[model samples]
Target: MLLDALLFQLGYNAALVMIGAGLLGLAAGMAGTFLFLRKRALVSDAISHATLPGIAVAFIVMEAFGGDGRSLAGLLIGAICASALGLAAVTYLGNRTRLSEDAAIGAVLSVFFGFGIVLLTVIQAFGYGRQSGLEGFLLGSTAGMLRSDATLIAVSAALTCAIVLLMRRPLTVAAFDPGFARVSGQRPDWAEAVLMAVVLAVTVVGLKVVGLILIVALLIIPPVAARFWSDQSTHVLWISSIIGGLAGYFGAALSAIAPDLPTGPIIVLCAFGLFLVSFLFAPERGVLASVLRHFRFRRDVHMRQGLLALAQGHPIFEDLTLKLLIRAGFASADGVPTDTGRARAAKALRDEARWREVRGDPAFERAAARYDGLTDLSDVLTEDQLREVDARIGPPVGAA
Candidate 1:
């Protein structure tokens, strides 16, 4: 009875955590799709680090404004301010300097983080009675969040979701073909700026559950995994959101059960694990699919080489001699290609009998060549390509 009651209560708490994480995950996934498409994935990481300065400034501002020792509103405003500054810096560096986009991101990330660290040290030295709680923002701990914090996250998530849905068509056009979008009067520049703002907002909300240091993992891993499962943008968005939200809820629950475990690391691990699975086995993009494709191509190359070899000599009237076909791995010593080894090789192509059947045709006579490891389409060819190939064979003997 006691265990049952405990299970019941755990389920209830899990539901609450899931609700908040679900909202946050949906926003992160939608915004992250565009980020990945735009090749601006690292921008999220830069903004997350930049928030440190904002948190420090928020604390300083809260003390000046005189209300509570800590102020969520101040933190939000300060973080947004710092994020805007970082964005401007990245833009300036990319436009005015020779730095690449990633380089600009790295530079801004390091400089702003260094400044935040200095501010942090100063706060500690002054020995303020109030705890800064800034460290929690670094790696995240859901235990530090309350009902009010959840409410803020929920509201931010709703705004992000609304904006993304409304801007879907323009964003898709810009991502797939920016030049075309611009020519069509889509105004991709303003769309890009608005998209970045949504990313920033989502990052801010994530800070409470996953922290600034690890939040980018949430934004990146889910979409990466989702891409392996679906090519369509809409399916990718929904699947990624589901995957991300599940990871967050499980990470939080695990931390709740084992008080020593950190929420941020656990959540990141969950998302990364899913990415690995997707990369290895997600249908079309999986490791298995690529290997199969390579095997099929190699087999086709070998068969085409064999056909060219026979054509160079003369067209055979009937089936290939057992010796010749066996040597080609299409038959056995008994003039039959039924051995398991031969079957395996044939399967790698199409079928063993099928190749022999094609070999008997007079037309197949010209298909074979000297087997010098290239297709020998000497007789059957396109006029334009044939002229190019014949020219490459070099000038007629006396013409040289």
Candidate 2:
């Protein structure tokens, strides 16, 4: 029964809506990679909030003109206009005033959202027809999504994806280093404009499925989560898109089954869940991985230190440390250095002496400071040069 409900029992409307939401997620995730790289994640929040007043105003204008006040086209047109204006305001404020991009984003988000609330109030008091559904734009309501709405979302998402793919190279260059891109004769401003357009399109389409408040999460979380898994921007982009699409698909499916839950928050929660998982378990970067790496590094350092002490006839501090060295073949059962252990200890002491000398140089102070508490000196000093230094100075006093 459960399997049938999941695979075969879904009605046509539910399937279409789910597909549309998934596509919207895919586009948002793709475009969001650039936005995340550029550190413009909050721009989507500003644009989405700014669209609220535009939606209300569009409905008012349509009613005044004797047309359907709830026309999707008219509402989307208003949303675009308002979102553009908000973008312009953010750019202007950031460039012309002392306000930074974050400050400008906050200012625009609050003012525009407040104005939208006022407009919504006016519509409720004096508008001719039902304005009840208009509030859905704030929190999102996918229940009323029609086949036409789904088709429109799919088309918009496809176009956005195509544009991103075509502009990938220049966009990536600009995203990482605008100055270098300009030096290479690429117009970063043009690339930024194109990116903003893509963000606007995604934001506008997402309003119905995820709503204005939560749509920014759709844009920001997937890329951030993907970043935990890879350092390459190309890998991040694909992973982010997959995570976003899955979030949308599964969230919509669950909502369809429940029939009482809101789709927007569920989608956001799914993305958040993925982010949390990545934060904890991603190889090399996740919290658990980082902790394990630190533990291994500390253990290695202690073992190397104990080997040096044993070579110099110094006291070995811990029984466990000695056992670890023996287990690793650096020492014998009697806690004496083996042939390999003596050579390793000599090299370790020599490298440490070289590292100390290099770190003391004024020229290397800054660079050496970056490796505080590091056990291996081989990374900074080559074996050939360290051997030369060892020949000249010999190992430290007791490290023979």
Q: How does each model score on lDDT?
A: 0.72, 0.85
Residue 329 error, candidate 2, Å: 7.7
Residues 289-360 of candidate 1 have per-residue lDDT tens digits of 778877766666645444433323323333334344556665455544444434443333332232333345
Which 10 successive residues of model 2 have the least lDDT summed? 1-10
Q: Assess candidate 1 and give its lDDT.
A: 0.72
What's the lDDT of the predicted structure labeled candidate 2? 0.85
Query: Model 2 — TM-score against the truth?
Result: 0.84
Per-model TM values vs. the true structure: 0.75, 0.84
lDDT of 2 by residue, 184-243 (tens): 988899999999999999999998888999999999999999999999999999999988
In candidate 1, which residue ranges exceed 4 Å CA deviation? 1-8, 11-15, 296-330, 334-400
Q: Which stretches of candidate 2 lie over 4 Å from their true place?
A: 1-8, 127-129, 318-323, 326-400
lDDT of 1 at 251: 68
